[model samples]
Target: MAKKTTQATPKAAENEQQSATAQKPHILPDRVWLVLARRAYEEPLRQVGTVEADDIELARVYARSIYDEFAWVEMALVPRETLVTVIEA
Candidate 1:
């Protein structure tokens, strides 16, 4: 009789997952967020914004809030002014 090897073992699967996670891009603590273009839509699917997030969870929270707050196109959390940078040496 011959023994067969499985396609994936528990340890192998875990290691694969770990490696996949490590391969993902590292998010920073803060990011430049576009303030506009997220409040014009009426449906949840329509509202979309871009921002730098520390993690995927934070990005999700921000997207949800933007959708809910702009349900009626009244309340907006995004800023009006363009991005500003000050350099000090």
Candidate 2:
């Protein structure tokens, strides 16, 4: 007696793939945002702190609300994920 093996058809394989993909958890982009602020005109922007949000607008809101204690002349938020490091410590 010999063992028998079965192979899935192309459509069945595709359906299985699709089902597996659907069953996997949907991963969302949660990023740490770097907050920078300048106190006055001609002042260099400095990193104040970081904020966490899923998108830029939400990050901006979070940064402003969290760091609003200072009378900053300007403020900006950049997703830390987009930054490239030139030097490593």
In candidate 2, position 50 carries an lDDT of 97
- lDDT per residue (tens digit) for residues 41-76 in model 2: 899999999998887888988998999988999998
Candidate maximizing TM-score: 2
Residue range 1-89, candidate 1, lDDT tens digits: 68986688899999999999998867544654443433445534232456555454665567557555444463223431354568833
For each candidate in turn, the TM-score is: 0.26, 0.64
In TM-score terms, candidate 2 sits at 0.64
Task: List candidate 1 segments past 4 Å from native.
Answer: 1-3, 28-89
**Candidate 2 local lDDT, residue 80:** 85
> Which ten-residue region of model 1 has the weakest summed lDDT?
74-83
Give stretches of model 2 more than 4 Å off. Answer: 1-29
Count of backbone collisions within predicted model 2: 0
Steric clashes per prediction? 0, 0
lDDT of 2: 0.90
